[model samples]
Target: MSDDAPVKADLDEIRGLLSVMPKADEAARDAARAREGQLTKPPGALGRLETLAEWVATWQGRTPPRIERPRVAVFAGNHGVAYKGVSAYPIAVTAQMVANFQAGGAAVNQLCAANDAELRVYEMALDHPTADFTDGPAMTEEECATAMAYGMMAVEEGIDILCLGEMGIGNSTSAAALAHALFGGKAQDWTGPGTGVTGSTMELKIQVVDEAVTRHLPEMTDSFDALRRLGGHELAAIAGAILAARVGRVPVILDGYACTAAASILYRADPHALDHCIVGHLSAEPSHRRLCEAIGKQPLLDFGMRLGEGSGAAVALGIVKSAVACHSGMATFAEAGVSDKD
Candidate 1:
């Protein structure tokens, strides 16, 4: 049997899972909302926190949601496009940062430690960098499928909440290309100064994205095709992980631009894929705002974070925990002997 056969089968299985993925339980959401009204706080006083609690309940299919296990998975890959000078940092930074992640010295490590979340980093084949999409597809369809499957399997260990992150220099270029293809916009619109590229470097980055989009436009009709053409293994893995989390009915927290770009691919392929996702924060990257709007997710925090190591999501886990606490631990008006609105 050809190697492609197994890859196709795996991808088909993912499709089947997505098709059967359950929607958030509206009954549970309404129950949580009703309980919020009965909480000691005035109606709507808690603002988005109350809404977040209801969202958690709806996704968990319970009145009182619990976030017992939160996991953050960081997928690292090398992009051939980095050779085109899209990022100020060299591609070697991808591997070095992966080592830093494993060493528990990265910002994401510190944030995960502070939030009591487990961190898992997968270092994809950095030596075999993905093909530059400006010339051809970044990876074979089979390779993309395999990477995605790896991501899907990562969540099987069981998690109540999962956050997807990536570490690949010039990934923002790949992300911009994918976003441009999915959203039907000029490359400049989705392009941003990733890793602080500016002036000539930023202009070069935009040009590279435009060229890649033009080359891949013919095959951009399908979301997976666009992904394979313009996305790195890490991005593909993030999509797979998000899909898997949704299938398991575990809520996902999205980090920043690169992560959201991957989520956008899943969202475009299956709108239901994002049913269990909560945007962790708004990234400083300009395209991130548009990406969130495209996916219909309002970020939980807006701390101007643009780091791509799941730092935003790691920090936001505290907010998710708080939301769960309010939902499961807050005293109702009856218990508190507080008067409700007459």
Candidate 2:
């Protein structure tokens, strides 16, 4: 840091300055549940959606809430480890899908349009098909500074809710590597057969992550170091955006493996970060369920989804919206002239 600049030497101090009191909103939840029971339906008839709305009320700290214009930001970058054939798709697919997202040709695009959520796409610095798996998916310090500037700018653009997505091809390997680094486990514990890779290819994928970790373990003694060493450009930026959103008091939805890995990194940096996040779905990645469990989050859906365009998060928007609506809009039994079943 320069002499003229604010020193960022203490993460604890930064957290202390930004951390807000978390409201459990128990009253709001109880009221919503009571209203749900009186909704002209049997108890628990609405399944998880009813419970989901109650949680949304608690998250928003209101008897009735509103999540106006939720924003989905998809970060796109290429991983250097793709040359090892760990992924089923080519590195070009990163840029290709980034274009698709911008052009509204991807699944996330359709879901965002259907749900009427605002979407933003950022291209974190990705070079073409580099083989330096040891370096990582992100850029140098200068690049991170630049990305932070853009991320903070996005936070200023008025987002009530946030969700993260990734479009990198070999990022599953990077995601597994980040999970192992953040969670202290074997690569096999956090890796899965991503995007239809065969069993032999999966083995190779695990070996690559193990090698990347082994090569960098000696140099990394901290969470940020491990992230800077093993995390992708988009993943690192997503981590930054997550932290930024959390500090800014906006709830963030996490997509599948790669986006979840970014959340894991942020939580390692600051455990309080998890308090502001919601898990969008349980992915088809064999390791994803375990990863979500590690964070004590049960995803709202499980459609055998392996597609990571933030589709899961996009789909969850309705549940969140309905939850907000019920919390803010529904009348209590007394107000609506109905008797409580209980």
Candidate 3:
């Protein structure tokens, strides 16, 4: 293993913790399915809800898994590359959108509220409203450490599930840069227009990301170093938050491309991180699809929605909740007096 790989001691410790994950009760699931079949509805009529419930039960380690009022945590920051004119919207929009979330006026706020989920916004320190490509990424080691501390603390705030969202202008550029450095991909492969940038603007976006990835190549030894070089403050925080959620044994819903990029970082840091993640939806960004495919996960939605702030994840949570309900509330063949065809 490389120096960046987890020490055997820590690996053993994390493995022990993982071993404690509650085993899914096959008996309870059978009973639950029996109940669902007996419900005043046709078998499997509920579609994915039936599978979702069982998955939730397995995740919660309970027969009747209840989410207990989930919450959304949105992390916001500015990417140094937004100054490169890669995105149509100005970097200032990140902070502006943060305020929008706080005011409960943004798309995420509404969707979360409608889904009965509380929203918390974190404004990580970063160089805001970037002017051009001259400025590099603003994620210093100190900033990453602070973000790690804050994100870990945030996950401790009594949540059954945590959804991660990011609001950083030029964040897509940062995501591509991180993807290239961490995943060994060409910048153009991961680069995409963010917030409706035009064709020429996207070309500039890819170029800036390529430059960032090239500059950081030698130092990109591991996930932390890659994040330190190319990650936005929000991305770092989200990565730490995902780690904390896994440690705390709570499911984490990924919001969009930006947060998915952060999730990739967490997975690289600890492969087990994927065990706790519930990919929310396929983002509108083309790169997001590639990233999801690489991670071996599927999005719940393909609605062509690219608005960050965890709106996509928030909508996806409804299905997650429904899944939990079905798994715990359904009836089996015996209960319904139906013959088993399986």
Candidate 4:
């Protein structure tokens, strides 16, 4: 091999990270539960809030889980398939939305501000969209691997939690295709009216998903192939970030249908792969509920959101912060001189 030969990225490296993925800290979870019992409240009255604290402790591997450095990453990419008239908006909207995000003019900006989380937008070669999978593989193995690598690098040291989101026009079609290929359902089951596609456009979206999966299914062989064959750069990046967050002991909140579809790839690779993450919300997209069931994670919110660029996850981060505040700040029964539950 020549020294100047292009260094190639391999999915095997991602699989290696998965094999070494860390599980939640059960000890931390137990400690959080013990503290929960000590809080001056009726047992189970706080409901999911109690479990929310425990979940944070479990995934962060620390008692009194902190949300001080929550982060939201929105990846934007163009898809070659956008040329197929699958979306109501033009492909140029992808880059334009990234600019709006950069200028703090998007919905995600306000949501992140409300949650006190840092918002970072990563553009995944907006000028170089993946090949349309209906025609061929959306990305070569190396291209997909590199995008995933870009996502992994989004995980910086000391982030308390990561919120995954995306911003590619027509990517709902990509998400549907990835889910259809990964989970073995009919194309219509995963396809939805993305970006307000209705009537004939919706039908075209489903056709695109079906044809893409049919063209690539024989060679897919595994979940990673499903991603590379049917996913966009931003989707591949989300998978990368999810894996990196697991390795770094950061809990994750995945946003909407597209983001969760990306994470589902890792879940298929290993059922335990998503142990450290949660779905941020129930998307208005029909397939999202089905996708969430397939991954065994319930949505944290049901605002009927479908905006995609991590907005839902960013909002859910506020809920996580609230859980941390109550868990860490509320006085215990002993401190408050209150009677314990009989």
Candidate of highest lDDT:
4
User: Which residue pairs clash in candidate 2?
Assistant: 53-323, 63-327, 64-327, 64-328, 137-232, 137-233, 138-233
Writing each residue's lDDT as its tens digit, candidate 1 over 1-342 gives 112324332555665676788888999999998888888887888788888888888887888888888899999988999998889889999889988998889999999888889999987777788998898999887788888887776686558888888999989999999999999889899999989999999999999999999989886668888888999989988998888787777888989999999888878888768878988999999999998988899898999889889999998889988878987898988998988778
Q: Write the per-residue lDDT of candidate 3 for residues 1-342, one digit (tens) a residue.
A: 111322122212332433444434567566555556665456788887776665555455456768886989988777666666788988678778877887878998889878899898877654443223235435556555556556656686568888888888888888888777777778888987778877888788888888877777775666776776787667877877776776665778888888899888766765655766767888888889888887777887788888888999999998888777665555556666866655
User: Which portions of model 2 show Cα errors greater than 4 Å?
Assistant: 1-51, 58-63, 128-131, 135-139
Clash tally, candidates in order: 0, 7, 14, 0
lDDT for 69 (candidate 1): 80
Consecutive 10-residue window with the lowest summed lDDT within model 2: 1-10
Please identify model 1 stretches exceeding 4 Å from their true place: 1-9
**lDDT of residue 19 for candidate 1:** 72
Q: Candidate 4: worst 10 consecutive residues by lDDT? A: 1-10
Worst 10 residues of 3 by lDDT: 1-10
| lDDT digits (tens) for residues 127-226 of candidate 2 | 5333456655334444444444444444544577787787788888888988887787899998888878988998999998898888877777666666
- Per-residue CA lDDT of candidate 4, range 6-91, in tens? 43569888778887998879899999999998998887888888888899999899998888898999989889999999999999
Per-candidate local distance difference test: 0.86, 0.73, 0.72, 0.90
